[model samples]
Target: MVPGIYRPRAVDRTLDRYRRSFSAIAIEGAKGVGKTATARQRAATVFKLDEPEALAIVQADHRRVLDARPPVLVDEWQRHPPIWDAIRNADDDGAAPGTFLLTGSADPRDAPAHTGAGRIARVRLRPLSLAERLDAPPTVSLAGLLAGDRPALDGDSDVDLERYVDEILLGGFPGLRRYEGQTHRAQLGSYLDLVVEKDFPQLGQRVRNPDALRRWMTAYAAATATTASFEKIRRATTSNDGDEPARTTVIPYRDALRRLYVLDPVPAWRPAAGSLGELGDAEKHHLVDPALAARLVRATKGRLLDGASSGPAIPRDGTQLGALFESLVTLSVRAYVSAAEAAEPEVRHLRTHRGEHEVDLIVEREDGDVLLIEVKLTAVPDDRDVAHLNWLAGRLGDQVIDRVIVTTGRAAYRRPDGVAVVPAALLGP
Candidate 1:
């Protein structure tokens, strides 16, 4: 996490493999997720457009990027929007594979002229996952699970509930790893502050009252890991005088935050074949990282571990610790699934329309195979805990390749019922 030292990222392997065939690869993510660090490894020619002088130079001659060395890296390239079109044009001119690497913290307000679907590829980078942050390599493979081979689960993790709490507080951000205590909390707070003070304005969304946005964000954080209605979330942000922000005003704030990558919501899962009836259409709320959620609601280790809940009063099923833990699990699974070779694997949540059945995470492969997973804050999950996972497996039948429960346990093993119980730390791509 030190400035000079570079830690290995899951995206590193993807970038290396992709650069061989793709003419351009755009690595996109929220700020401080280490896009530049990862892209710089593959870049020979670098244009740090974030710098004022560099921006001026690029602004004057945007086409200069097309002539740079193979594997050109345009850091924070949104500073000059046309650079994307220039790269696309060069790709059309038969540019060789690995011709460009564009890294941006946010999408440019000025839209790209082309979708670049065939010309360029995109790789997303997120805050470090639980497996990425730990010392030991993970033993259980999410890729293996998606294969439907029912592989043996074997590994022991030293990561316990307290350690997970620590991770939730410290978060997966690369540079923020070195900070601890009040400094760490303050740094997280400051990061959120920047989103309000700079990122929103840069994205062309005016913040008339930063405090109101912050409160809404805090309420959204309180709704982490739940398919809470937007109206409910908005209502949670209401004032004592029974006044609420209008929907028209709130929609722009949500859209702008999404554009800034400040919000990472998990869309509800609906089976493509329509075998599962009437699925919920709501999205489970989450921030870019659980540490941000923790910071937004001011959740501390003791408060989270002791089953304390507070903040904007959004209704949810479990304890504050449990929701944040699910958020952490979601982050880890998302990071792993992105690196998996399962062919268009997606991370989503599943909830029946009547709320009779729901699972924390679902990795639905392109071929309709499902790896249904549940998250429990405890080290051990009883029958009641995995009931939904079992029910979904029964519903999906052969399509349910693997049913797993991600937990804070010390060991990774399979149950007699044929479900896999994995310590979150032991899971990898």
Candidate 2:
């Protein structure tokens, strides 16, 4: 029996809705995002491939596990990637909907022969959103915005800047949420350590110098929300002798990290059908979770409260806390947007070549309509805060479905020009 509380995930609804039509569904995310527990709730018989006994059985005959029951779950299925094709073959044999469920923490070392496109639907399960983490419910729905319904933006959350700092340090990992102080800090530290020491090697790329990899990771963490170039990060991880690893050497590290789902950077947005004048191609740096980033830079709540910044490893526009807040918002937006699968919006970042204008988050519909949002770590958003939103609105005209400034403010309201000002706590899926 799975023990402990199961906080309802936003993806639960999506999983339920999709499994009805698809034969299999794969829930993918970073480790410890509660993928197993969430899948267990729907599974009858589970094959935990990570375990020796279960793996031994699968090795003996892969079909043995499949014979246990229908609606069978194969946890850590990436451990034995052939199971993916086994399930795919089952689907090819006309298996009933929702017959097989697979959950993976990281991508398999060997890629599956088949893509499982039509037979198995893949849903991304990310960390908990602000609404899931907090007691008070969100007032504004992301789905509503995507629908262009323009619902009333009215509600309040006591989750201020200080509380946001607490959330940033606390992180969104379900199991680790209850820990505080040094214990919590240590757990996050160990999580990062495992990523470098174990997770990377498991993904088929052995780090010859773990220390160098850790430094690179720390430097990347320091980059957080900025679009800091790879050259900058390479220099930051320089050795004491002032020698840095070759760019060729560091390239594989990012590939490995990405495959492990450690880095979740937002790609630059390009309008599908327009000349938007030199949209930057660089991706905005972000880890899977903000707390992991905070832990990498050793950002304590007290230090963050004091407006302390991390190492000069990467150049940043504002404070680390602010960047983290944007990251937290990005996570929430992705979660909310993912849940709105019917009219799912593609979330990306926007930046010009000269860096004259930039918006933190862009939610673009399949039809190319967009909802632009700017995340601020402040209580009240004045005209200065909404300047970029205004600028983008002028450029995009009616193509801009909505403009928003997400802040740590108390209330959710809109300005005279129709740009919505929303508190992060008050926004939901």
Candidate 3:
């Protein structure tokens, strides 16, 4: 176990649930999101696949090696696909419970092409959200209001926007957190190199020019916090020759990044009552860590502080930071949902045909209730800020139980219309 750090409540909650109900739990996320650390801290015994000795032992007798350690924690289980079957067999025999905790960065596509049922309970591990880092108070009481509780709105608190932006630029990766000065840049540079050199190859892609891929990654970074079409990305990266790769190439690379636990795509959400044909079908792209996006922009702390351009500046309109803020809110909400052991909430973007209205996020509950959320970087709330949410509430009637505006502002209060305007800082775990 790593010393000198408080356990993340979200992770601890997940571990508890795994111990109670599931024989095996798969903790998945992008690289450096703390899966290995969390599993190691909670597991009674751990077998690290990256170790040569462990690899040899598994290669010799996979079943014996796994069964040898009851309540085993297998780090990077994807490295040994046979072990998945072994775990399944062990579980089927009802030999014991809490026998395995599997952690992997690779997706099912890279995992031997088959993952049988009842093998594991899966959880998508994301970076430490702002609320998790702050160890925020339980606000699901407020979240519960969306389910028809009509709870009182918790007052908001002040947050330093500049520092918050810095956190975002620095990202949530634990490794990057320790480095200072140019060392941080060097570390992130090495990270990019590994993604291009090592990770891409592992995903079974044959890139003749890794440098070109790196360039494309940089271009994507510049376009981060915005809704850019994949075709546009292709045009930006493709060579003059018609022989350039298709938009399909972008998907694999993006998926590989996602599997590695980096890139995150924010899907557009339309109101359930609205006609599907009216809403736009575009997904806004966001890096799993906004700091990754900042790195992609090639911006330094000095550059960001100076408000100077490093690469192309991401627009500050409704489409850019607004989308990023929504993604941040989603990440926070996901952490909360996972901690509660409640039904997983689905996040969707809202839009209409005539462009009459739009909402940043729509959290769809399992019971068909919807919570409409709007995100803003500004602290001061205005009529324009909750305009879309109010419109949706009016249209959907009681179906929209809660309307919230998450912002960087100083105070949290309820508006006359019963919508809550909350500051991001007060949004705790």
Candidate 4:
């Protein structure tokens, strides 16, 4: 969806770099996350497969893709899974570098015959990050912080708690940026409705109980930022056939949602070597954007600001705003690291097996160094707030480069104990 202005995303840099060397780069993400727009920027020719005429043309002869100019974009290639093989075959038949760009919204169950391994390079295009949203010129560089240098942390932000809550509910889906008030709310609701009503079926998965799926989604939304088990979330809804939802039924719903890039769960952090001492392997549940979670839980600005817990009850540590704030921070951090050209880093959460101490995010570099982060709702970092950070820092010693607290406060600075406190709006890639 090309929406007038083309706001730069963190993934743009990665996509641009990969396109020069790799002939086929598949930009994959959820629907309406600017996949088409990002790919269109670098594409010499575009195949709009979602359109009827374009589909007919492509279906007639997949080899027609070979005729387009360099950087030929196959928008929604999943619309025709054969295009993948066609592209791969073209690659084998001496296609030049930067020749094909594919964008996919849904990962079809019947995937392309070829896994495209060593042939097609895949890049994820997620929702806009905090910095990409251009809320404020990001003062702190995540890349800089991850460099293990004690960078001078200093920035001021007017983005208070209330504004952060609004941002959380508004979400970071770039296409929905222009809509406001009732229209915006309606669009988000319709987005969720479409996932249940249309997206599920289009993925070739049958939703026997749409209401149950919606409730499950809502319940999953409630479990945001928490490691709520699938069983707990599944129990929140009742199937049309009665009795608790079966695993056979619920697994499809979860798998389909994942294929749609709707449910972005953060996998538990496992150290490459030098064990973190029995870490928990439970994945943290998070929607693609926290705003989706807010929407599913019907978290209004007033309700969120008032700290009213909405939607199905799932065990969590803090207020509704706090969870979404962590989620908002999670999205931003993930985007930042994804764009980082440094030695392949990843974003993960850390929790001990016993659950005594946990870090909200663990940005670990290729060398086993880590940036421990804890997201808090308040601005200042107290001793109580930095307890886990301090504990992990002492345990890891030199491996712990930076311990940070992402907040909705007005300023960014470091505590005497070396834990940095940064406003969510001021942090960037």
Candidate 5:
């Protein structure tokens, strides 16, 4: 078992759900995102397939080895695809409740001839949120805010804007948490190398030129936090070659990144009564970690936070920071919703036909209740920031249950129209 550390409350919630349902749980995420550590911390007994001896033992007598340790935690189960069938068989015989907890950095689709449907309850684990990094002052809960509880804000301190930017640039991989200065940059570069050379090939993807993929990834990093059309990405990447890869190829590459738990594309959402044509199908691209975006910018560690003040000099038309801020907000909402066991909400970008208004995120609940969220990086809240959210509430009327604007500002307040303006720093799991 892994040594004791700060147990992620979110994983605890997932484990509880698995126990209640007698379901096999699969934790998927990027390399170095703490999957093994989190699983080991919770597992009764762990069998690590990465170790050669364990691999030999599992291949020699798969079922017997698993049965010996019922309720086993299999780390990197994707390494031996046949073990999945063994797990399914064990589950069928009712060998034990919560008999298996599987962890893998790769997706099941990438696994060699494995059927994981009946045996696994999948969970996608991303990097730590800004609140989880112990970077800024902590945020309050959305559940508390929705329940009409107003927590006291202890006013902002001497915020280390530079350090915060550095953290954002380095990302939330647990492996890069403690390094400082040039060492951090070196480690990040090494990480990118590993993702391209080692991780992608292991997932059964045949990349003729990893260099081209890396270039495309860099381009994506530059365009992070914007509504990116796949066609635009294809055009950019295919310029050198007369024959361009199809949208299908681009999607799998993106999915490979997602399965690694690094890339997340926020899709557009339309009201049930609204026409899908009116709402664009384009997805706003976001890296799972904002720091990855920062690396694409090639910005020095401290420049990310100075984005607004730095004016139009920065890339992506001065919207890079705002996009990262929006990505952060999206991640926070995803984390909160997942932890609360709320029905999986569909996250969408809201835009109108007239192009007069736009809202960053509209989380539509299973019960037809909508939670509208807007993201801003400014230290002071402005009415202009939430105009679309208000417009959405007015348009949807009774269909809207909660209206929230997550901002980088220090205070939390409610608008006269009942929109909750909150500090992004205060949002936590």
Candidate 6:
């Protein structure tokens, strides 16, 4: 129950389940999400390739790094890309299950020596979910809902809008969570600064204009939880001097940020069921952690409470708090879904071409069945709130295994119409 002590992550279950059956597993996520700590838990021998001495040894010969005992942890394996092929070759030479555990903050700029298809399975470690942050035992299960069992939803959380805002500003990054007020904001600023400065160059994309990159990132942060087009985002980043970076410059900027795992945009869902027609192709923008977005825009608790909008004056539905709340819900739901499904189901957003309707998050199973979710910042949702979910249910019928409205409400329960209402805190893996 220590504040910063290792709270078990939802992804731990997935790691445990797969580690015993796979020779190698790669854990990927944005920096500061605790990838190293999580991988260290399961590793017998760890080579932190980020450290100069450790990286030097590996650079001299990857075999020295790979010759360790079973369950050897290669922290930041992407630092020395050859370790991937070495691990793959070891797997080919009959490496035992769980022999190598690799943690990567970013994908290698160049492809690894081996593709690591069947040899190494990949798992993502996202920011801490609400359940993990609260250290609360989950009362409602995503797996149960996905099973089409109509499981009873019942639980209550003391977390309210104010506390949710605090979480959003404080962020779910383990290291940054301990600070508060200006200190918390400062740490988040530093984290983003690192991403813009060090993380990008390390990934082989030297940011020539750090200020311009920061402006673009701030603009993207402003677009969180909305399906804003890249053109609008580009416009938002236009400088006071009446200049905007060209498409060629913007492309590498976006690519570098994504490679660093900073921009975690939710792709628009394309249902195999063609009945859902003319879906929008725009992706919903989300920073890896909402706190980063809040910090980039200098959003404070008072500013959020007073309903002050942050960041570029981009058009978006609802207030900044609401979009952040939705981002929080999306983050937690994705974490839980990843833990529950083990394979990390396709988590995406839904929107029509002409701005007709939108679903907050769509979780699709491999079989093409989908779980529909709508996020509401309000404590209680009325019929009007779930209208889109109801519309989707009517359109997709039985294909929607279940519909849910994730809210900031206190209780988790189901409506008579079968749509489950879950408080963000009460719902988990």
Tens digit per residue, CA lDDT, model 6, 340-386: 75456789889999878899999988788889999988888999899
**Runs off by more than 4 Å, candidate 4:** 1-3, 238-243, 273-275
- Give a tens-digit lDDT track for model 3, residues 21-42: 7788888887777888778776
- Number of backbone-clashing residue pairs for each candidate, in the order shown: 0, 0, 10, 0, 4, 0
lDDT digits (tens) for residues 1-429 of candidate 5: 123465363546766776666647787777777788777765777888889998888888886556655567888888887887787776787756677888887765646465657566777777766666664545566555433244443344333445445556667777687776678777877887888888888777777767667756776776676665666666556534455566766777787888776787787777778633376666778877776666654656345555542211223434566676677667666666556565445677776654566778777767777777887776666788778888778888777777788866666667676677777766765
Weakest ten-residue segment in model 3 by summed lDDT: 312-321
- Evaluated against the true structure, the overall lDDT of model 5 is 0.68
In model 3, which residue pairs have backbone atoms overlapping below 3 Å? 30-260, 30-261, 136-428, 136-429, 156-412, 268-349, 269-348, 269-349, 269-350, 379-409
Worst 10 residues of 2 by lDDT: 1-10
The digit string of per-residue lDDT tens for model 2 on 1-429 reads 123978888888899888899989999998988899899999999999889999889878978766768788998888888889988998888888888889998987696978899888998888888888988889998888877766668998888788998888898889888888999999999888898888887788878888888788888989999999999998898877876888888898988888878899999998865666887889999999999988888888878888788754578888888999999999999999878868567899999887888999999998889999999988888898889888988888888888889999999998887888899999998
Candidate 5 TM-score to native? 0.86
- When sorted by TM-score, best at the front, the candidate numbers are 1, 6, 2, 4, 3, 5
Q: In angstroms, how far off is 234's CA in candidate 3?
A: 2.2
Per-model TM-score versus the true fold = 0.98, 0.97, 0.89, 0.96, 0.86, 0.97
How displaced is residue 57 in candidate 6, in Å? Answer: 0.9
TM-score of 4: 0.96
lDDT of 1: 0.87
lDDT of each: 0.87, 0.87, 0.69, 0.87, 0.68, 0.87
